[model samples]
Target: MFNRLRCGSGLIQETVPRFGFGPGQENLFVHKFTFSTSKRLDRDKSLIYNSQNKPLPRLDPSVVGTGNRKRAQPVIQPSEKFNYSVRKALELIYYEEESRIPTLFPAGLKLSRYLKSRTLPLEIDLVSRAVLYNTRQSKLEKIHLQRWAPVDFDKNCAFSYLVARTPAEYAVLVTIFREISRLEPNFKPRTLFDHGSGLCTGYWAANTVFGKLTEMFCVDPSTDMNDLATNIIQQGVQNVPLPKGINFRLKAPKTISLKYDLCLSAYTLMEVKGSLERLDIVHSLWERLEEGGCMVLVEQGTNAGFQIISEARDFLLRLCEADERDGIVDNEKKGEVLAPCPHNHPCPRYHHDTVPCNFSVKYSLFDIPYFSTEDVHNDLFSYIVIKKGRREGFRFPRLVEEPLKTKNNFYCRLCTGSGMLQEVMCNKKHKDLFHLSKFLHWGDEMPVHLEYTDGKEKPRPVIDRSERSMSSGEHFRDSKKEKDFKEEKDSKEEKDSKEEKDSKEEKDSIVKNGI
Candidate 1:
């Protein structure tokens, strides 16, 4: 469902000056380097895990399609802690090297210092103004306009890029990976392909979400990026020396010839120059999918990202529909959306009044090893998950945002049944439904049935457990069982006492009468 506020705006984990430039996985901006270790930036302004107070929109019973599909998906969340020894060591090394280089090697330090001083907001404005106003959009016309490049591709820059983006990028990847794992439990891909691997965020996501990827083929045009990915991943996982199972291709092939169980293109389509050109990339990526294979496309969560996801969704659906219409696939469904959509209808966000779908999750540097500040950008992303072959499974409607609460109701924004974002409200009267809403966090599949209505969705939400997996009803049931047992035992004891008293009275009367 579209939140008007969200419709206007929102993810790049990249800080200031690191723009997505070049081709392949190079579209994701390089991560910024920082020297400070503060967890909160402007602590008073930033909310620490604001999600706690975050209000989700409501789900109206009247608007909802009815059924009890509300069976919850198994809880999938990232572990609270993971091994970060490698990162910690690297950070210390960088700090020491950074301090020594400025004094001994004066020239490079000037460039580093200048880059470090840049902020994200300032860069965005400068780039937009230059592209839109100064260049008269000429830069945009050329397809790959150079916004700005801070430094040459080198080991140090690459290391800093990956480290700086790690916290935010990991959060984004974890969410996508978790959902993918849930969607395809039986899907254990023997081979994987990563397009625009960008320090292999896809690999990290895949490894975390699904324990072992049989083999990984990572392709990115930048040699520096490929090296950085190999070094960082191997160091973190102790797979140093570039394991035989993982291959990093530093050059872009004229075409992608390899087929794999899973393929990923993360935040790279924007570099393709033209809309149709980007679609060509999408088509090529789709062609590489083996039967029953899956493809995941990701983009930054800004308006541009959402727009691209919308456009891509349209193209993929059209391709599937055309395949079906042309009888090309021998009477099988050619493709289907796996996540963030319950149905394969045209994107609801494409409509002018509707907002594009995106997912948001929070993270902090404190959660990981050797970072300057606790503050990190929240993970907001517009993504699409597609599978090659048709599957028989439940595609639950996703909760679009945090559900909103009110005095009498909760308005839940959900994307379901062909990608329609609708608001459904559940009042205090619907105890079970309302209880389920509390268990829901952002980006969850509503475990219940939701219907489409012709009426205008009521805007008023006029609305989790504290990490416990138990639902509200489960607690009630547990208490009810205890109550029922006590009542049954008390009734049995009362009956036994009455019988004993009656028998005693009868015996006494008989003895007194001397019958």
Candidate 2:
């Protein structure tokens, strides 16, 4: 017989009463209990058994490994060398707004006014005037006046330029030099020759990129500029001394006997009076380049600046052609365009009137009183790098415009190796290429192969390889050669027509005779 029994949560117990027959007699009872294990213990045992027996579901190989993933291509950026040097130089020179406020204020104002004048649109009167001659013949004559004059950099102007323009110039130069280094990693220049080296910005940029040079020759016509450059190199104190193997001259060397591994002429062409003078300067700089050396030319990014750079590019190319023709330079040592262009052909945008082939670099501005309040600014510049040796290796198309990204695709405007501008579209279907293209920016090289999506390639421009010459303030072709060429072509055409007519007449006679 069983009495009432109860079980607790952790343990189970049971009690039984004996002898229910006795009416008022108390019965003895026995209880039995046992401890129970928790459910967590059972779960741990099952997990261990399952883990040892069952294998993990095979992971999708593609999602489980990093080896199959594509790494991002690094973007080319402007170096901070110039910015760092500028801040350091300013510190070394003890540049303070409060100390030189009086001197800098007027100079800054003058410089601003001068720069504004330079940027003003140049106007020329083309109205013709009729003049009566004694011989009763009236002739129409047009008078043209010069609209702008070059700024003469005095001590104050030089100082102003150093404070305001040097950082931007240095940024542009460093960008260019870094590009060269990227393209030609083995290139190391021992000597540098910088013409019109305002404040020695080229020197500083080159030194930063290539490290210490064996010799640096800086030529500037402005004595004030030269002094300012030397003072800066001396760190604002005469006792500090100039850097080793660096020399500043008020004028370029008269002879080209001494050549340099690198030659630079930045913003100097715009200062010259005429195209011929700029050409002369470019020629001189080209001559100063050693064999297998590189020459860099830079100017403002304005249309005029672009024209100046284009002219220099063309002139240098022409020189290379002439040298090759005359057997002055070997095929391996001939000059070639190194940057911003994939071909030696004429520039694609050269004929375009409104558009100029220019590039911009972002740079930080130094803190100067009465100057720009912005910390960062863009320097728009037109430049060309010419190497004395033939360009080697694969040529990649350059991105001329900023890449436009859409939800599923991106567009790029590229200056191709065929010397043509092309717009290309890359979509998600391209997979990795589309992802890589997103990192590309303006003035960067597109590594992917380009093809016409419509299956029709654009025609290349036809440039006449005629014997051209630069003349007095103009570019001209020899009239005799043009006349002879035209005559020869006309004669060939006439002869071909006559022969065809004779053959047709013969056929007609034979038909009549047969009839």
Candidate 3:
């Protein structure tokens, strides 16, 4: 109660309005609030959508066991705040059947309203399970379904909104952060914009990424969904307030009125239905990005998801050419593929059903207490990031396959700009390169030079002594240094608390000895 300042109605206007513009600042920290009174029909059902850009922290070399095999684990962990929401979801749908009252949010005034508006149907439990399965399977098979409004809004909001949808978005945002951080380690976003801001999953993800956001805006179309999102988002704010400045709107903006550091269209493009309309909306959102800003789009890791990402990728490539001819921009700044593709070339795996242009990253799976089996999750997803400016980096390509040992050398499948899909080998004679190749992973970029065109043979890409590969080594060293610093700090703190530790030990001895 003390942490949050309630402002659902006219509370903001009545407050002291401590919002201020810092010295020598014009547009910095400008806080404004406006509500759209206009309503809409045909918005019964709510499908909320959800970002982040943090590079995955380097793995400790010591983590590998004596056998030299390293176990890859999810680099991200859900915050305690997020876990609290998950637990709340568990109570709502499951415990509600037993007539259990929610104990977490004591401010049940709004929640009770939703509960009293209608009875929780007997079929809610079954329906929630069926709906979850349908959504999960739809993603796997690339099947599209038109969402009809839920009969029981509470159950839907609990299972679909808080449990399933929010968590899925969080996973995508985690990977986005990791990949983005790897691309630009110093990326500190001032503003984050979420399209289809269902429940502000992107907001939560942004916290796990940048840890600081100056301002954030979320827009959704469904009133029911918006209400639920607002309620939950506000509740989340009670514990952990992220992005110091935050706002949520009920309606979508007609156009991009303000530029953003990061713009996300996660699992949202599919809602547009029409390819052209989706592309047009994506283009508009892209335009809203400030120069050097990043735009990330996440879709279900199905064939349809792959296709939509492919179309968006091609659209980005042609944007510069079209702009040059139509005079859309003065210099025609080209968009660059930030991740999932080493270069902006046609996806060779486009038609390959078995191997589509996608990468699967795993996240920690969450299970509800009693219904763990039914709520089992697969954290796999397909996503792509496109940058507004040139993606200046390497010339070779990225490995889509894990490096494996052959009869004499190490080899992997690489997705290259000119070479397309090709097998690259690291000869054993090149001991340095070979040893480095051993560490080459499925999502890592390959450093060797290879042919862009299959028609001719090109010289092997040369890796100089001061090549970019050393960045991984540098990251390892930096991580080690940080670990050492933390250990030293912890040791000093422990030594300083020696008296307290001895006192605790003495008390423990007395208790154990039954004194």
Best prediction by lDDT: 2
lDDT of 2: 0.67
Q: Encode model 1's per-residue lDDT on 1-515: one tens digit a residue.
A: 11222223542122111111222431132123321111112111111111112223334545344344343323223333333533543454445533443243334335334333322121244455665654646656333334223345475655554544444566677787777777888887777788777677777667777777878887777787775566555554433477668988864456667778887888667545456767877887788788888888887665556667777878998898898888887445489888777777876544512233677767654333333343444656788988888855876678877776555766676666655455567777867677777667778777666543333445432113235555559879977998999999999999999999999999999999996
Clashes of each: 40, 0, 9
lDDT of 3 by residue, 1-515 (tens): 01113467432212111121223432232112211111111210111100011111122333332233234534344667766665564355345522332332232334333322221121344445555676668464322232211333344443344543455567778877777886777677879888877667787788777886778888766666655555455443344443357877765577777899999887667556466777887887787898888898887655556667878888877886687678876552667788878777676656321344556554443444433333334444567888887665554467765555555676555676662555555666756566666666666665555423432444444444444445558879978999999999999998879978899999999999995
Candidate scoring better on TM-score of 2 and 3: 2
Task: Please write out the lDDT profile of model 2 over residues 16-127, one tens digit for every residue.
Answer: 2222112222111111121111111111100111111111111122322333233442222223544444445556664663356467656755774444334212223221
Model 1 spans with C-alpha error above 4 angstroms: 1-85, 88-157, 236-241, 254-257, 366-377, 451-515
Best by the TM-score measure: 2
Ranking by lDDT: 2, 1, 3
Per-model TM-score versus the true fold? 0.62, 0.65, 0.58
Clashing pairs in 3: 48-198, 52-177, 53-177, 54-177, 55-181, 55-182, 418-452, 419-452, 449-461
Per-residue error at 366 for model 1, in Å?
7.2
Query: For model 1, what is the alpha-carbon lDDT of residue 436?
Result: 70
Whole-model lDDT per candidate: 0.60, 0.67, 0.58
